[model samples]
Target: MAADDVSVDDKVKRTRDLLSSFYSQDASQISPPSNTTSRFATLDTINTTSFDADQYMNLLVHKSNLEGLLQRHVEMAAEIKNLDTDLQIMKNNIVGMEVNMEQLLDKIMSVQSKSDGVNTLLFEKREHIEKLHRTRNLLRKVQDCKKASEEVMLVIVNKLEDKVSSDSESIQARAEAVMLLKQLDFPVEKLESKLLEKLEQFLEELDLSKDTSSDSANPHESINEGIESDSIPPRPEVPTREFVEAVHAYHVIFPDSEQHLVKLMHDLTTRHFEAAKQQIQEQVSSAKLSNRLRFIWTDVLSIDEVLPEAGLQDFAYEAARDVLKQYVTSLFSYLLHEISDALLQIQKDGIGEEYPLRAALEASKNALIQGSTKVLSDIRYLLDEDLGLVLKLRDMIISWVQEGFQTFFTQLNGQLLLLSGKDVPTDKVSSGLVLVISQLSVFIERDAISRITEEIGSSLLGGSYEYGSSAFYISMRTQRISVLLRKRLTTPNWIKHKEPREVHMFVDLFLQELGAVGSEVKQILPQGLTRRHSRTESNGSTSSSRSNQLRDNRSNTNRARSQLLETHLAKLFKQKMEIFTKIEHTQESVVMTIVKRCLKSLQEFVRLHTFNRSGFQQIQLDMQYLRITLKDNAEDEAAVEFLLDEVIVAAAERCVDPSPLEPAILDRLVQAKLAKTMDQEPVAS
Candidate 1:
C-alpha cells in the first residue's frame, strides 16, 4: 500500500503541475486526484489474479473522470485571467472620465465670467442712453431760444435799417434843396412874390375865360397845350426829396409800376425819332447826282480790251470813277437813313440796352470804316487815270462815308436820350430808311455796268440796254444787313431767353420775299429753243410776190439784225450767269463760316450753363472783365474790322469783273464787217 500510495501521490502531483503549466493559471497550486492515479497504477502493476475485468474497467473510468475534472479547472482559470484584463481596462476608462469632468467645470467658470462682464457693459450703456436723452431735451430747449433770439434780432435790424434809410433820405433832401438854392439865378426873396402875383393874374384870366362859346374855345385848351409842350421837351425832374418820394411812393403803391414807364418810353421814342429825322435832314445833302454809272460785264465786256492798249488803265479808272461816284452818294445817304431808323426802332422797342446801342454804333462805324476805303478805291478805279481826278473821286467817297458813319453813330447817342423817356419820333424812318438802303446795292451794280459800257468800244454798244451793277451791289448790301439782323433777333441770348415769336414772323416774311424772287426767276426762264413764241410768229404772216422778194430781202436783213441781237443777248446771259455763280459761291463760303461760328457759340453756351451754380456768377463777372479787357485792347474791334475788310471786299470783288468780254466779242464782229466792206468794192472803179 505504501509504495503504490506513494507512486500514485507522485503521479497526482505531476498531473497537477502539468495542468498548471498548460493553463498558465494558479489555482491554489492544486494537486490532481491522487486516488485516481493510485487506482490506475494498482490496476496495471499489481498482478491481481483475483481482479475481474469489470473492476479494472471501473478503475479506468475513475481515472478518466479525474482527468476531465483537471481540464475543466484549467478552462475556468483561463476565463478568470481574461476577466482580470477587462477589469484593468475599465479602471483606466474611469480615470479618463474623471479628468474630463474637471475640464468641463473650468469651462463653466469661464462662461460665468464673460456673462458677468456683459451684464456690467449693459448697465453702463443704459445709463449713457439716459444721459443722451437728457442732453437731447436740453438741445431742443436751446433751439427754441435761438429761434426766438433770431426773430428779435431780425425785427431790430429791420427797424434800424428803416430809421437809417429815413435819416439818409432827409439828408439827401436837404442837400438837394441847398443845391437848388445855389443854382437859382433870381433873388429868392423877390422871386416868390412876383411868381405868386403872376399866378393870381393867370387864375383870374382862367376864371374870366368861361364867357366865350366859339368852336375853338375850350377852358382846358391852354393847360393841355402847356402839358403837350412839356411832353415835347421832357426834362428830367430835379433830384428833390419830393420827386424821389413820389417815385418811391408810386413804386410802393403800385407794385407793377411799368405802366407809367411804358407810356413814358413810348413818348420818348417818338420825340427822339422825330429829332433824329430832323438831324438827318439837316445833315444829309439831297442832291440829284448825274447818272454816270455803267455795267462792266464779267467776260462779256472789258475796259482794257475795249480801249487802246495805252488807254487801258485810263479807261478802267474813268469807268470805275463814273460808276462809283453815283453809287457812293446814294449809298451814304441810304446808310445814314437806315442807321437812323434802326436807332429809333431800338428806342421804341425798349431794346436799346438789350441790343447794346454802343455795340451797334461800333459795328456800324467799323462797317463804314472798312467799306469807305474800298468804296474810295473803286471810285478812283472808275475815274480817268489823271491822278488828280482819281484822288478827287476817292476823297469824295471817303468824305461821304465818314460823314454818313458819323451821322449814324450820332443817332445811337440820340437813342440813349430817347431811352431816358424824352419824346422822340424815330419810328417813322424805319421803312423809308430800309427802302433806301435796299436800293443802294442795286444802284451801285447798275451804275458800274453802265459806266463800263461807256468806256467800251463804240461797236460793243449794240442796243439801248444798260447793266444794273449798282443795283446788284445795293441788293447784296441789303441782304447782308438783313441776315445779320435776322440772326441777332432770333438767337436765344439776343432776346435774353425770351424767344420773341415776332422775330420768327419777320424772318418768315424775309424768307417769303426770297421765295418769290426765286419763283420769278424760275417762271421767266425759256423752256426750250424749239418752242417759238406764238405772239412773235402771229404778227409775221402777210405780203405780195415781187413785193415779197423785196420783203424777203428786208426779211433777210432783219434776220441778220436778229442774229446780232441774239449774240448780244447771249453775252448778257453769260455775264448774268457768271455773276450768279460768283454770288452763290461767296454766299456758300460765308454761310459755312457763319455756321461754324454758331456751333462754337452753342458749345460755349452749354459749357457755361454746366458749371456749378455758385461758379456761374463768378464766370459771368470774369467774362465781363475779359470783354472789358478785350475792348480796351481793341482786339475784338480789330478782328471785326479785319473780317469786314476781308469778307466784304472779297465778295465785292467777285461782283465786279476783273476781265470783261464784250470788247473781244465786238472786235471780231468789227473785223468781219471791215473785211466784208473791202470785198464789196468794185474790181475796177
Candidate 2:
C-alpha cells in the first residue's frame, strides 16, 4: 500500500511537470511532455499486494456499473460525429447564398444608372418645346398686324379708282379711309404726298400721249392745221375735258385746291372782258359795233362749251352781261353829249337881238328833229336789222334802249331849261313842246311801238296773222299803240307840275282836231239831216165852215211850197256827193286814236294837279262841253265818263289848303258848270 501510494505521488508529480513544460514551450508546436519514460517507470513500480474476499465482492459489483458507463460514452461519441457533418453542410450553403447576393446587387446598380440617363434626356426635351411655343406666339402677332395693314391699303385703292372714273363721286369715302389708316398706325401724310406726286405724273404722261397720237395721225399737217384739228378749237382757249377731269380728281382728293382753280378761271374771264371794252371804245359805226357784240357772244358760248363740267359756264355768262352793259352806256353817253352841245350853241347864238325869239324857236325845232332822226336811225338799224340774237336777248336789249332814251330826254329837258333862262313865253314854249311831242309820238307810235307790237304778236301767234290783211291784228295794233302811248308818253308824270301847261294844251289841240273830224263824219250820215216829228190837233167844227177855212189856206201854201221843194232837192244831191268823197278818204282808226289820246291826256292831267276855285270851275265847264261833243265819236262813252269823274275826285283830294275841299263841294260846282254849259249848247246850235 505504501509503495502504491509512493508511485501515485510520483505519477502526479510527473504529469504536473509535463504540463508545466508543455505550457512553457513555443505555442505553435504543442505535444505531451518529452519525459514520457519516467512516467511509465513510475507506473511499473506500483506494488503487487494480497487480495481479500470482501474486497473482491465489492470490485465485481463496481465492474457492472463501469459497463453501463461505457455504453453512455459510446452514444456521446456518435452524436459528436453527426453534429460535425451538419456543420460542414451549413458552411457549403453559406458559400452558395453569397454568390446569389452578389449577382442581385450588380443588377440593381445597372438599373439605377439607366434611370438617371433617361431623366437628363427628358429635361433637355422640355426646354426645347418651351422655346418653340414662345416663337410661335411671336409669329402669330406679326401675322395679325400684317393682315390689318393689308385691309386698309385695299380701301384706299378703291376710293381712288372711283374718283377717276366719275365726276359726281362723293369724297366721303376717301375721308373715311384716311381715318382708318391713322387708327392702324399707318403713315398717312407721307402716303398722301406720294399719291399726289403720282397723280401729277399721270397727268403729264396723258398729255404727252395725246400730243404724240395727234402728231402721228397727221404727220404732214402744218402747225395751224394741227391746232385746228383739236376737237374744241382754241378761240376762247380753255382746258380740255380730259385735263379738267384730272384736275377735278386732284380737287376731290385734296379739297383745299378748288378755290385756287376757281380764281384762275375768274381772272381769265376778266382779261377777256377788258379786251372787249377796248374794242368797243375804238368802234365808230353801228355796223362795226354790232359785229363786235356778236363776236363777244360767240366767244362766251365757245368757252362755256369747252369746260362745261368745270363750273365755269356761269362765270362766262356774267362776263358777257358786263360787256353788253358797257356798250349800251357808251352809246347813250355819246347821244346825250351831242344834244347838250347843240342846246348850248343855240343859247350862245341867240344872245343878240338879231336872232329873234321866233327864229330861235324855229332853229331849236330843226336842231331837235335832226338830232332825234340820227338817234332813231341808229337804234332802228341795231334792233330791226340784226337777226341772229335770241328773242330773250333781243327783249333785254330793247329794254336797255328804252331806258337809255328816257335818260337822254331827261338831260335834254334840263339843257332846254338852262338855255331859255325863263325869258321865253309860256305859249311859245308850249307850242315848241307840242311840236316836239308830236314828232316823238309819230316816230314811237308809227315806227318803234308798232313794230314791237307786231313782233310780239308774231312770236305769240307763230306768224299766223298778217299785218295789213288781218282785221283782228289791225285792231290789236291800234289798241296796243293807245295803251303804250298812255303808259309811256302821257303817264301821270307828263302832266305833273314841272310841265303841266304843255300837256294840258296838247290835250286841247287833240280834242279840237278830233272834233273837226266828227263834224265831217256827221255831214255824211243821213241821221244828221232828219228832224223831230210835230204833233197834230184833232178838234172838229161845221163842215162848210171847216171847208172854207181849209180851201183858202191850202191853195196859197201849195203854190209857194212847190217852188221851194224843187230848188232844195238839187242842192241836197250836190252835198251828198261831196260827203261820199270825204268818207272814202277817211280812216276810222285815225279818228279813234285821236279821240282816245285826247281823253287819256285830259284825265291824267286833271288827276295830277289841284287848282283854285275859278280854275276848277273853268275846267269842269270845258269837260262838260267836251263830253257832249265826244259822246258821238268816242268808242266807249262810259269809260270816258268814269275816267273824267276819277280825275275830278283826285283833283279835289289834292287841293292846296290846310284842309282839302270836300268832294261834295266839287260835285256841286261840277254840276252847276255842267248846267251852264248845257244851257249855252242850245243857243250855239
Candidate 3:
C-alpha cells in the first residue's frame, strides 16, 4: 500500500511540472490547443507507458462521461449556427430598406418638379386675370361715357327742335333752350346770327303793323295834318314779347347781348325822363309835372315787363333807381326855387297873425313829404316788393329829402341875414325856432324814423333782407339832420347882439317852454292825495246828534273806501302816463341841452366883451328872474344856480367902469345864485 501511494504522488508531481512548462511556452509560437492534446504530458506519458492498460480500462468504464461532453459541444455549435443565420437575415433587411429610401427620394423629386410647374402656371394665370379685370373696367367706363355723350346729343337736338318749331314759346323758354345747348357744348355762333336775322325781321314786321294801325285809325286825315300839331301822338307800344324772345334768344346764344339791351333800356329811359322834364319845365304846373312823372314811371314799368322774369326784378330796380335819380335831379332846382319863393314871401310879409315862417316851413315840409310819397308810391307801383330794392329807394328818397331841407334852410338863413335888426322881430324868430324844431321832431319821429324802424324791423323779422347796412345808412341820415339843425339854427348871427337882454331872452324862452311842458305833464299826474288830521270834538248831548254821528261814521267808511279806489286809479294813471312822461322828459332834455350850450357860449362872450355896470345890473336881475321862474318847473336847481353864478362872474370879470361890485350887491347876487340850502351869510374878503 505504501509503495502504491509513493508512485501516485510521483505522477501528481509530474502533472504539475508538465502544466507549468506548457503554460510557460512563447506567445509568438502559441496556437489553439488540439482537442486530443494533454495539458500534462507526464500524465499522458505515464498513462501511455506505465498506466496505459489501466487508463484504457478506466475510459472503458467511463464511456458515459465522454458522451455527455460531446452533447454539450454539439449544443454550443448549434447555437452559433443560429446566430449566423440571424445575421444573414439582418443584412438582407438593410439592403431592402436602402432601396426603399431611394424610391421615396425619387418620388419626392417628381412631386417637387410638378409643384414648380403648378407654381409657374398659377403666376401666369394670376397676371392674365388681372389684365382681364383691367380690360373689363375700361370697357365699362367707355360704355358709360358713350351713353352719356349720346344722351347729351339727344337733349341738344330736342331743345333745338323745340326752338325751331314753336313760334309762341316764351322768351324764357327760348333763352333756356339756347342756354342748354351751350351747356351741352354745342356751337352757338350760327344760332346767334340766325336770331339776329329773325330779330331784324320781327322789327320790320312791327313797323309795318304800327303804320297800318295808324292808317286805319286816322285814314281821313292827311299824313302832314298831325305833323303840324304841337303835341306828338303817343308812340305805339313796342312788340315786347316777340322782341324780348328774340333778344333773349340772342342773349342765350351770345351771353354779351344782354348788356346791349340793358344799355338800350337805360338810354330810352333817360330820353323819356329828359322829355318829361323839358315839358314840365316849360309848363311849370304841378298837375302837368305829376302827370309827366306818372307817365315816365309807367314807361319804366312797361320796360320791366318786357324783360325776362328771371332777371326782371333786378333790371326793374336798376331802371327805377336811374329814373328816380334823373327825376330828382331835374326837379331839385324847381323845388329849391319854390322853397326860396316861399321863404321870400315870409321875409317880405313878416310872420303876421298867420305866422308866415311856420306856414313856409309847413309848406316846405308838405312839399317834401308829398314829393317823397309820390316818388315812393310810384316806385311801389312799378317794382316788385323786393324789400332790398324798396329800402334802397327809400334811403335815396330820404337822402334827397334831407338835401332839400338842408338847401332850404341854408337859403333861408342867408335871406334872414339880409333883414335889418329892427325888421327882425325877436319874438317871431324865437317862436319860429321852437315851432320849427318841434315840427321837425314830430315829423322825423312820426314820418321818417318810425317808418324806417318799421320797415327795417319788418325786414329783419321777415328775413326778407339784411338791414344791418341799411339801418346804419338811415341812422347816418338822422344824425345829418341833427347836425344840420344845430348848424343852421344856433348861429350867433341870428341874434345880432350879445346883450344880456338878448342872452336872457333865450333863457326866458327855455324856461317858458319847460313851464309849458311841465304844466302839460302835470295835468296827468296822480291827484287826490290830500292828507287828513285827527280831529278833537266838543261834546253835545242830544239823541239827534248821536244819530247824526252814526251817519257821519258811515260817510267816513265810504270815504276810506274811496281813498283805496283812488290809490289803484293812481297806479293805472302812472302806467298810462309812461309814454307821455318819456316825451316830456325828452323835451326837457332837449331844452336843457340847448340852454347849457347857449349858456356856455354866453359866458365866453361875456368874458370877452366889456359890460357897463347897468348891463351887469340888467343881467343880474334877469338871472334872478330866471332862477325864480325855473323853480316851479322841476329844473335842476343846482344847474340853474351854477349858471347864474357863472353869468355873474363873467359879467364881473368883463365889467368896464366898476372898481369892484359893492359887498351888499355881491351878497345879494350870491344869495340869489347859490342853492336855497346854502348859507346866506355875506361872502368874506
Q: What value of lDDT does candidate 2 attain over all alpha carbons?
A: 0.46
Instruction: Report lDDT per candidate.
Output: 0.37, 0.46, 0.48
Per-residue lDDT of candidate 1, residues 375-459 (tens digit): 3333333332223333445556545544544554465345434443356465634443333333433443465334333322111
Cα lDDT tens digits for candidate 2, 375-400: 44444444543334423355665566
TM-score per candidate: 0.14, 0.28, 0.25
Give the per-residue lDDT digits (tens) of candidate 3, residues 39-59. Answer: 233224432323465664455
What's the lDDT for candidate 3?
0.48
Candidates sorted on TM-score, descending: 2, 3, 1
Q: Give me candidate 2's TM-score against the actual structure.
A: 0.28
CA displacement after TM-score superposition, residue 35 of candidate 3 (Å): 99
Clashing pairs in 2: none
* Clash totals, every prediction: 62, 0, 0
